[model samples]
Target chain A: MPSAASSQLLDADFPTRLREVAGMVETRLDALLPKPNGHQSVIFEAARYAALGGGKRLRPFLVVETARMLGGSLDEALSVGCALECLHVYSLVHDDLPCMDDDDLRRGKPTVHRAYGDAIAVLAGDALLTRSFGILGEVDLPADVKVKLVTELAMSGGMSGMIGGQVVDITVAEGERDEALITELQAMKTGALIDYAVRAGGYVAGASETELAALSAYARDMGLAFQIQDDILDVTGDAETVGKAVGKDADLGKATFVSILGLEGAQHRAKELGERAKNRLAPWDKAAQTLRDTVDFVLERKH
Target chain B: MPSAASSQLLDADFPTRLREVAGMVETRLDALLPKPNGHQSVIFEAARYAALGGGKRLRPFLVVETARMLGGSLDEALSVGCALECLHVYSLVHDDLPCMDDDDLRRGKPTVHRAYGDAIAVLAGDALLTRSFGILGEVDLPADVKVKLVTELAMSGGMSGMIGGQVVDITVAEGERDEALITELQAMKTGALIDYAVRAGGYVAGASETELAALSAYARDMGLAFQIQDDILDVTGDAETVGKAVGKDADLGKATFVSILGLEGAQHRAKELGERAKNRLAPWDKAAQTLRDTVDFVLERKH
Candidate 1:
């Protein structure tokens, strides 16, 4: 699909395709979650509220598209995709809590805590987190593969990964000039899960070791570029356009790629990394066209 | 070990044995967690504080003893035991948060939020929850078995289980009591994990379906007996002996077995359940002697 004829993602209505997949995930999630009724049903409502509306669904898209690229079953990939999205949303819900990021707005809507009181919001996130693993375990795949996927997802999001990264991000002193620490923080905070998205698809598709490694290289570079672009957007994008709080990083004087490397430098690095990421799929030829286009989109996305 | 020759549990120091296992789990948790030296080291410190230095280790002990009874490797069961404990402690940490039960102390120490601030405490629980899955994934076993274990753990502790039960416990209205709802609440809130502890051991040991069913029956009754005895203790025991607040259930006007059945009625019920639970293990006979003894201990213990 990456042939010159398909080089333009617009040919396939890229945003339209993303929206459809996002919609599909929303439906799947709705069906998978416990209905909001009975005692403490508010948590289910809150969990649905946190997961159902808004956001780009980028991680789920990666799982589905990558699995499709590797000739895996779309249905199976979608199941795992929903699990990934549940995890991502769980993180967002927790991050927006008053005790955490203290944000009231997310995706042009009130954050879970703001909408449903802090206590319910906390339970919503916890329920969502637990639900993700349960969903993964229920996927119709070979047991071993499912186990590996759960393990990968857990490691990527656990203490040494996404959650761990968040801890460091919020604790670091302002104006510290340690680029190494900054990179590690970003790698753990965001890169770990993004890398796992690609890896999860590869595992589901039974990709060989060499193929999986190649996928990892592409994902790693893409994740870095994605974060760089994110930092750029945080500095340059408006809250309305970004659909959430922005410039807070600057206001808080948090170290970012754009802060250490000048704006132009960060942009240049993002472009270089994006290209390298797309190039890693060259061995797979046109089969990885969607992924190649994805890297391009990541660097170019306004949000 | 519960034979006439081994009746000297106090002489052999049963509490001492419990403490030793608790100590071992603490060491393992210490090794499993991220070292608390980085920017957000407090989360790690708090997670350690929440998980270590507390509790009866009843869940972990169940895993170890059950697996040993089924001839599974002690090392494998202990690994799973620690994972279960991580999950249990995570619940306690979150439950004690200001948004939930709002308790100030647990296991005779300040709650995580009180000690490390609410945000760090929240993150600590999140980290520990994530860490539990990571640890389960890392266990040295067949991938399929590990997957089954993870799947079972998630199901038992997830929205449909412990978390779901906690949501109900906090949200249900005062009085207007029903025995069925009360039983459901206690089962989901406490029994689910205990059932899984036994089921986890059986899975590790690769027990036959008959054996697993037998284990499940024993766990189910034992859990009920344990909780009933607990309610009795809350009414009869003091803060100093209980090591945490007591009488809060009655204070909150919550409907418990003691409230519904009356104290004497509840005590008689616990004894009946304990006897039934012990009888279920007759097939394994002397092999399940320790578990039988545990049921007896649950009925008679002061705290």
Candidate 2:
């Protein structure tokens, strides 16, 4: 295991390094994709809206961290992180569209549909979704690892996981829901992609089966905790702070952990889950401590 | 080269075999994907609308045919075909969203957004798009080949190509049209993916560089011809037969080859391109004759 001082250096420099890596990845993403032309104009514009829009670089950070922990270069992990971000942004763009969540704002700005209209927003999401794998496939990685990573991403983001969770969330929003059902929904909708991000990063780093299993468990716990925090924040945080309309979840009668668990209970659960996430990383090198810290930071985040 | 009699056998039985392979491929797709559970109702329903809703199985048929041309098993190619179809369906779903094209119908049925609303539709498209690569990654093929196939698919579908073309198309739609600009758009929007399908199928079969180049050229010509024919069909074909609204190009004032070339000129160009596509395939074994025939069929089709 690396020394505590070295690990501290990783923690201190991680954000700057991550941002630099993200910037490079974004450049590569831009360089690789051809501008949309002809009848596909709206789709292209929408893709740009979704992908170029700003968000936290958490997934990419995981890709880099996991890769570094596994003795892989950051360059190898850059594409994976960028791809994950693309997938994340694509989901947000589509989720905020008129027909799905009907959200008009995200990340402190107009959502893709609000900025570019539904046609372009929809296409933007599609383009981003496809482009995520495109980035991954272009990266110089072992073919088997690449295949595994792509498969994991697809499954996590697809019908059985994220989409599945969204379906349940929407359906339950219109009708009745119980605690069990709501928990299951969050697990699928939010948990799946988060799980994929950590696992994918581990995959790029050549993590062993035990490490992947541990990382997956950590992600699953962290994801649920993160969503719970989000729900809590929706009630307690300012709209300006969170970058979208707050309390909208309550207005829509959306089922959430806070709604069912109550604020206090939700907070408690988040703390417990964060602790569990940290425990999962106990066997990993000290380099992974920041990931554990992120679990706590995510749960306690004000925005 | 194989005898003309072999070519005749391939043509006569190929579609039947292809259909059978499609059925098997569909089953594989069904098995690989998560079932539509109540939680993911939106994603599940939308996926069904886009994927199971009927479209000509043209891309999948091409995959099967190309695999056969290379003396590979159709069963082996079925997953690849299914992946391509998922990608095609994903694009269509997003393309028809209210944000993108504002399309209410597809294939004479309500589009995903119309049927399920926009949010679910968007997620559904995202799900399908991600799932396509997932299917490709998991297919029982060599890892190196899978990597190559994925790279090809991503490049064809991503920025700098399909997405990039879409951007140009949208920008150009807001400006005066030119022949060169229109051709560039067409190449990226349609030609890139079509080229990918042929090249990817060949790559999966371990095709030689010469074979890949020939197939790619053939597909490029066919793709342009196909788009031109589509433009012609938009003007001449009935909406009911075409399954989507016709004359949309005229209504939107979107620039197309037909709009620029005039109807007669577009037809002539399509015919000539179809012949060129067929000629490009001349070096292939007689088994490739069906692909050549399909190009001609695409150009001559009434709808």
Candidate 3:
């Protein structure tokens, strides 16, 4: 069933492409983040510090790769990628606050709150979140497309999505085992933003309704697979390799896929979801090869 | 020099009009905010608590009155006003957090952090802020106009604006008697959003570039006047009248307009700025009467 383009894409070096997109997004993030130099420079400095230098740039990779797959301009996709990265980084910064996760380390470095204190960390997270939307205003897309992107990001990041999931994560009773709640939480907290990144990539490309639907389904599966893999990693990953403390979720007794489903069961579900995600892209054929590879990478990633 | 329209506006029941707008914006905010009833309903409940039934609604008043004067649709303007109010409420929620201002009361009610705990309070603030932009997407404006509104709001609420000023406010050493720094802080913290409200009103109506410029200058003066008045009230007003603890600024040794300019000097400056603000609206004559009265209201408000 594979066409010439599919064969070419299959032969493509996906990890290399992912790294290249990551580099491009980091540069864009650097350019977009405000330079620190005034009385308020401390906030900007902390925002930059929190946003730059670390992580796999996985969300940005999704954005850029999906857009590129759909024939959108690389540069426009890069801008959106940076915006999503800022949002993801902001969530991390706030989650690390003393009253939140209280984590002191992220990516082998001191967290924003640890490095700059709680007030600046809070402001820096806020500034980055605001700047994410501001970056959309500067993208070279048409007005309607930009508006759609804003709405999508806002919805995904707001109460019904990431923040909703976070509230549940913090408020759920200890040792309470509810598979449905955990599933919904995973879908909302991490999955919503992942879904947004993919859909935004499609939006930037003016992808057809059919294409968008397929992208949505693909992302839904990928997001679940991603979360399960994350749970697996947390159970298996060491602090040095994972770039932050591991086993905290276990220590906190937070419900995760690996908790609800044993490690083998979680891995099985991830594999099944990854296959479904890749199959959803059958229409795109060769252009979807890299995305398919991404699913595999997510299922296999050690950190 | 006052036009007939100006005379009519001047004679208008300014307080009644302000209250009406506040009521309208509150209704819209209620409609826009996510409803509670799920596992994460606590966050929604907290967000609703933070956003509803408090404060003067002065910012919403500015947005509506300005848009109405320029012949924009009332419904559309109300949506924008609600969005601005949500952003405002988000700032208040975060500013009252333990690591921030450590306030126990807001508008005579328990602050969000006090009512919902620090974690939920942070999530509520984040949710409200995100919903603010989501509201903009539903407004009945042209796509480009909506894009402009998003940019305006994002910029006004971000590092170069409100958050920037907030960082400076907390980071500035106690008893730091820098007049210019205080002015910059006031402009960034409060002036930016106020300016956005005015200009967004203009954008909604497709106001001429010249009209927008006039609105900007008027809002700039009005914002400074508003802050000076706030500083004055903090010094002179009681907690019962102010609806929050008063004299906290003095207690904290923070250098406010009252501290830097002295009570009389600050009062004189606010009056001068109010007059200048009113003068900036000379082009609109009677149509701007409500706005002109707003300047007087800002200068005269006890709390």
Supply DockQ values for each candidate.
Answer: 0.67, 0.54, 0.81
The DockQ-derived docking category for candidate 3 is high
Model 3 agreement with the true structure over B1-303: per-residue lDDT tens digits: 453244323345878888888888778888888789788899989999999885678887788889889998878888898899999999999999999889998877899898889999888888888888888877889999999999889999999899988988788885664788888998999999999999988988899999999999999999999989998999999988876679999997878889889999999898888888888998887678788888877777777
Q: What lDDT is obtained when candidate 2 is compared to the true structure?
A: 0.76
Q: Could you give candidate 1's per-residue lDDT for residues B134-228 as a string of tens digits?
A: 78888887888888888888888887789878878877775655777878888889999999999898888988889989888988898989888
* Candidate that scores best on lDDT: 3
Worst 10 residues of 3 chain A by lDDT: A1-10
| Model 3 CA deviation exceeding 4 Å by range | A1-12, A235-254, B3-12, B238-240, B243-253
The alpha-carbon lDDT assigned to residue A27 of candidate 2 equals: 74
Q: Write the per-residue lDDT of candidate 3 for residues A185-209, one digit (tens) a residue.
A: 8889999998998899999899988
User: Runs in model 2 with CA error above 4 Å?
Assistant: A1-54, A235-254, B1-33, B165-171, B232-264
The TM-scores, one per candidate, come to 0.94, 0.87, 0.95
Question: Candidate 1, residues A101-152: lDDT per residue as tens digits?
Answer: 7998887789988998888888788888888888888899998888888888
Error of 2 at B125 (Å): 1.4
